[model samples]
Target: MKTAALKTVDRRDGKLAMAHFYVAFIALALGGLAGLLQTLVRSGKFELPAGIGYYQILTVHGVVLGLVLTTFFIMGFQLAAVSKTSGTLTNRQRLIGWIGFWLMTAGTLMAAAMILLNKASVLYTFYAPLQAHALFYIGLTLVIVGSWLDGAAIIMAYARWRKANPGKPSPLLTFMSLVNTILWIVATIGVASTVLIQLLPWSLGLVDRVDVLVSRTLFWYFGHPLVYFWLLPAYMAWYVVIPKVIGGKIFSDSLARMSFILFLLFSIPVGFHHQLTEPGIDPAWKFLQVILTFLVIIPSLMTAFSLFATFESYGRSKGATGLFGWVKVLPWEDARFTVPFIGMLSFIPAGAGGIINASHQLNQVVHNTIWITGHFHLTLATAVILTFFGITYWLVPHLTGRTLTKALNKLAIIQAVFWAVGMTFMSGAMHAAGLLGAPRRSSYSEYGGAAQAAEWIPYQVAQAIGGSILFLGIILMLYIFINLAFFAPKGEEEFPVGETSEKAEKTPMVFENWKLWLGITVLLILFAYTIPFIDMIENAPIGSKGYKLW
Candidate 1:
């Protein structure tokens, strides 16, 4: 068995990771406030002070939380994971990571400033026709480029480990981190292409118009994988860390690796599912991508099964008997476990909602409706965000050389409960209201007091109440984060990485074949996208002039 020479992240590397957390939490604070305001406005009970526009705050909410927060936290967590598993980064690697961090940070600031100044209110998707300032696109480009540099650090470390270990699969955490990094690098190419080749020049006035359909195509190409990019790290926690937290072994190393490989292969090529409702794409191509979307579900189910097996095995060994008795043995009192467990439970319905959205017939029902917003809230906001919170309960303290006091742990649990309750009220109402035909991304309006519009009022109020509760949850989370980072009692906290169950067979070496995986991922992308893209460009319209409605 292998053992770590150090129980905590290297002090220098911890500083780097801490830098990211600082920015991420700052974003949470700013973005959380924006979200609350949005809900209140949509409830028909609030208005912005001064000249603040609704879409401007909406842009802030989406960009800061959706893009900035997720990217920073994921990059930070992956860096720490790679360091913990593969050993501290070499000096060169560390330098590269720092450069990436600063670059991304700078980009975030530039983008944020533009949003706040109302120079860019294009929203997170930044879809063309509703164009923003050139700096907005440039800032986004820097963020993507900086992330590539950040990924380079992880890649270099993985290479070093392979060179040293020769013939052994990389450490599970390290390997997962590398896989996610590669997935990110590959997927971002679509967004990067649109930003560099299309959006930036159009925003700069070098082009009189932008191709709306083509821009959206590239965006969704990057957008769908972006979901998995956020998700894979959470899966990393579920697959590797959770078992250790609950005093159990991994169900199968091979299963875990295979699932990740499946994600890499299937996630990017399937972005067309998001574009299914849009015109200009052949129904046949959309159907093909829909098939690919369903294939992505296999890994999701595999992950679910592996987790159940881990929990059951742990419960069984602890003297539990009946089929569901394993549930009783989990560490419910441990905030680290309970918090993310809530997130895992949320995914049940969240996943179901996603399946509904991907269906061609069902897409028409919810597309551009508040129902889609509700689905997004459940998936990313509740499921992914809660898992991240659960991770913070240990991660912050571990990196900071502090211990999570029982009091703080209890508070963390409370925070998670608040989140669950709030989202139930909020997202549930959204889904219901959407079914009644409420539109998304609209400011407060009675729509000439139309009956259907009036029908949405009560649900919008429920959303406001839910948003208020969630903001409280955010405040609690921020308090806990502060205590963990600074005020918590000084001590060591374990960075848990689970051991694979002995009963599982050896992992195949082919899982480590980057050539096979990347080649397949590229081929799938080509197969799914090549023809449609060619058709889009060939039949493209005269494009659109930029508009700044906000």
Candidate 2:
């Protein structure tokens, strides 16, 4: 239980957190609408009105949902977690965080306007040789820099806490928040270098061409770890918050901390796994990175085990009989628990798909196909998105002093069900169609009704139907949040923080050694990336001029 002194809340920090979440939801709404349009257009039954193109819709969908929404939400959620768990943020910290938030929001708007005007149809990846407006790159670069400032605010807060309470292990939630913030700051270095030094200059006409291979190499350097950037927050909820909602304690705090540390060590160097299919990277290096990719899975497996153990222990305490009977005893009625629980379940298949993607031989079969798309939806769309939904049910009310209405509570459950059903139809079909050699990232009518192409139409229709249902689910979520934010009855809810069932014998000092882990992570990244990067730069081909393909 938190002591009275420890439970103090900061109004300024809370306001900052709320501001971040509000912007994130706006992106979510806009992105979901664009996604529905993309699904319809790809289904071949819907056509864009004059002046709008399919690729523009797609670029907006990916950029808003994938980049903007996730970045803002994670920053807000982590700031809140850190402040609540460690202590209230100081006035300076709050001011710094707010500045970051505004810079990020401004950057988002600038890039979004460019996208809307069809000035930058480059997809979220914004791979080189397919340039966007310089403003688009500049705006995104600002978002990254802004996020770094927010991370600095968080780290500074943690540093002060450590100074005041020397030798005390950080609270697990605060520790995990710090881990993710640090991971993000470190991982973005590659992409920041790419944008600031390469893409921005090329886009602004300071340079006529860019080395495609080198640019791509820099992107995936940041890109694959970007997956973990979206995931670790969800894992934070799974490991630290869900157990308390289910009337249980965390299974093991030490294991959880170790997992976070391992993620720091392993996540960044493994990005080359995403480039296994590309040329210019040596096969030996790609194979080595694939092994590192497999290493990253260890932390996730640890997370899965820890979560299940928490669930199983909770079940047995409730008098569940037999070994597996505990599974049936979980708190399925609570949206806070069930939504994240379902997210955990979804990760099983998502993790499997990731392993398949990492396998060099299997990757050749599925690379750039709709299977990858299905896999994407399974991991981020279901696992990350659903957990965020669960966080919303508990978090909004916690921050706003508003009660989640009984009607909205029931609606939350329905929302999860709708999302699952929609993703099932949509991603399942995409996976099947992918195996049959259906293309991805294209409008299907481009195939001109070939025999093989005709086979994918029904699955495309399934995806459209599924996407429509998912959009409805998001709409319902927005309604619940809006009601809670502005109109629900005013009442404070306790922040849920679970303790470990067994007290540790001693504080695990090794787990708290951030510098040690960070240094090792950097070394691993250098080992994995140094040679390939040099090879690409040294053997540069005639660089390609930027294209406006869309």
Candidate 3:
């Protein structure tokens, strides 16, 4: 192939990855505005001027930050991982990727516009009985469809790479990309069907009294998996980027594959956990999802073990010994370690809230409180957002063929670490406040003169301090993109990450064979989700659902 054609493919993939970065950061900025406003409202500091509508801002913040930003970033990361593992991309395939990017981008913009104009006020969940404009449903469907197309492109590229290079176990990067794409294909179909067959028609008034249960079940069938979809890229970095940066091979490529496959199978029938707070869902169905929900810890724990083991090997190779000594030996200065560290730490509270929210009894105390927001913010901020920045800094020197400024890069890592630290203290406070019955969305600090409610004020104030640290950290991270565009050396320099490209090309299965783990993964997932689906739909009465998807 001509150098021009190769450069074309390279440039397209690189730009799309960065496109996701830009879009995600912008979304977070909006969410931060809403989040800060929410804090202020609770703190009794400031309120939106008249017509600035809290519900609308909340909805915008939620959808933009939660859905669009996360989705685009994953799509972007998939392209990067696939390109590295597959060796090269075909030109036609490259174009499809960009087209997918544009469609999702347009759909996201249209949906965000609806939120800003106050035409869509149904909140992010937009649970029915409350409806958003028809355009909201249509726009979201477009986003889903666009993502499906991106998944298809990835699937095709993986196949082509496989055909051209036979009998070799697929590279870990390509393998993970396939699993994510397949998961997305199965996952998004539910919401797409719900939107096309039920929600959209009802919104257009073509149907009267649409079965609320049907749409709600389908919407969440996709919804729960979407969270995993948002999360998979970070997990990818954990498996691939972390070990490479530590100068260690992954402990078990097979384990990583097993975890990804488990995610696909378990994530589907697990939607019922999300509905535990709402009324009208079949009680047995809820329990089934909950049971499966807890099972997720199995795969997650495996991931933790695998990453730690990888860290252990690196520590041993570097001549460190014992359980905790390895911790100090690992290079925290590396962006990969820094991002993964922040990501893993953030999951501590997120996992706790996830467990409480999943449990039938505990959820009642803090459902929909500021604690829930704190949990997800910790999850997103620590996991995907920081990792996205980390991965970008890791890749940019190679992509632009420019030597990145070491000082600014280190600053980015500092800011990211600080963001994670801030969320830790802040999210902990949110938990305490929630237990005290602090409300989630409110502009007035008065809390209707409920004294206990009023006592939670300090935690809310504490979150602003956390938020300020987080916001400044974001500024340092964002400065890199600006710095890159305006300044930076023209040629790539030798760097410590000299090993990543080699490893991406060939990641050895350090301990276990991926094929064996792959089989175990399939069995576990099948066991986890199989009965849940039957109990959810087959056992429940027709039209038995209580809530509707907006």
Candidate 4:
């Protein structure tokens, strides 16, 4: 068996991965600024200057952070993890990665240009009848395609590893990366289909009308899975990397693989949960999808249990006593562990909020409300983004042939604390306002001094304060990133991957049986969506002509 070694990522592969990070961080800087401005605008304390529309900034905020930043960072981190664990990518694979990176970058620029020109202020969701410039659709299509190519590179690398090590399970990190790549590729097909078949044609005037329900349905199909796409990477770090960081063994490789498999199966078919309140979809199908949505919570809870077990095992080994004593034994000062630890802590509330969102009765109350917005912020913004930040504490330095210095490490922990504080204020206020019936995706207004609208203003102002603090957090993160990438001390920083515990059974080979899992995934999706989808098309109304309300 190939034992774990202190191996640096190949310099060539590092360059490819770093290219993705560069774009990711750039998106963060721009998107974070846009986010700050959005909070200020919605707080009714500031207005866009020089005719820049509120929706324009909103579009930038959502697209850059929600789509661009997440996609780029995830891709970059996965590539590096695969390379470190599986072996360096071949020259051709690296070439494919570069091509995908540039394509995504070009697409991002094209789409951004249109948005900045005020011709594509449709927001990140870009749901029609809110049409954007044709270039915007085309640009986004390129991004999706580019992501496919990037995924292809990861798949190829995995294939090569499996071929070389015929009887062995793939490295846990590599396997996890492969799973996420597959999930992304499968999930993106929904968004890609909607864009190519529906939105692009309508935006280009090739089609006079677009099906709003179908477009939205397709979007939510991709949309719900997209959150998992952001999340599974964090889970990878949580399951495989965190144990190694904190001087503990993986609780069970089998359990980890099982949870990831469950996520892949349950994550994709539950889009109707998002559309529960929308018309034209049958409640039965919605209920079924909601059940699938709830099933995904199983894997999440499993992960939590595994982590607790690992922590307790480590603490007990260290002679710590008492039921919760393990928590005290954890390496609290290690940024690599502590930063993502905060993210893990945040997910408790985040997951609860998700359960509330997915519930049918509760959905009616919070539907289209800022509560949904708060839930989203907590899930991706705190849980996922903070974990990504944690990864960067070591990843950027490791890739750059440097070490995370003590000062920088301390800064990273501080940055995470700032993020936690800021998100609490922001997301907390959003939930409060949303429960009070504040609408989402709208600029500030008093509704002619209506008392209900008046009630939301205080929360909005709290959001502004939180956003400002979050912006400072962003600035700190960027500073840490720049130092890690360009100026950190020249040395080796380990790319940690944990070993499985001896007490755990070997990971089942069945976990690697893609055909079986994928087959079930497809069947579940068809069972949930195929009938409703066909009902949509067969009973379709005359589609609405495109509108640019912004």
Candidate 4 per-residue lDDT over residues 409-513, each given as its tens digit: 899999998999999999999999999999998867536557777888999999999999999999999999999999888999988889899999987788878
TM-score of each: 0.98, 0.97, 0.87, 0.98
Give me the runs in candidate 2 sitting further than 4 Å from their true place.
Answer: 1-4, 503-505, 542-550
Model 1 misplaced stretches (Cα beyond 4 Å): 1-3, 542-550
lDDT of 3 by residue, 369-471 (tens): 7777676676776776777677767565555566567786687778777777777667777777777777675544456647776688788777767766776
Between prediction 2 and prediction 3, the one with superior lDDT is 2
Candidate ranking under lDDT, highest first, comes to 1, 4, 2, 3
Q: How far is candidate 2 from the true structure (C-alpha RMSD, Å)?
A: 2.6
Q: List the residue pairs that clash in candidate 1.
A: none
Q: Model 2, 1-550: lDDT tens per residue?
A: 2323555346677789889999999999999999999889878899999879888998999999999999999998999888888888888998899999999999999999999999899987988778888899889988998999899999988888788777878888888989999889888988888898888888888777777777887788888888999999999999988988988989888889989888888888887778877888899999998998899889998998888888888898899988799978787788888887788888899999999999989999998898998999999999999999899887878888877777878889999999999999999988998999888788787888889888999999999999999999989989888987888888876678887887444548787787788888889988998998778777776545534211
Using TM-score as the yardstick, the better of models 2 and 3 is 2
Q: Residues 1-550, candidate 1: write the lDDT tens digits.
A: 1336756788888888889899999999999999999999999888889999999999999999999999999999999998898888889999999999999998999999999999999988988889888888888988998889889999998999898888999999888999999999988999999998888888888887777888898898899999999999999999999999999999999999999999999999888788877899999999999889988889999999999999999999999989899999999999989999999999999999999899878988988899989999999999899999999999999999999999999999999999999999999999999898899888656476678788899999999999999999999999999999999999999898899999999988999999999999889999999999889877776435434211
Global lDDT scores for all candidate models: 0.91, 0.87, 0.70, 0.91
Off by over 4 Å in 3: 1-9, 441-446, 493-550
Instruction: Itemize residue pairs with steric clashes in candidate 3.
Output: none
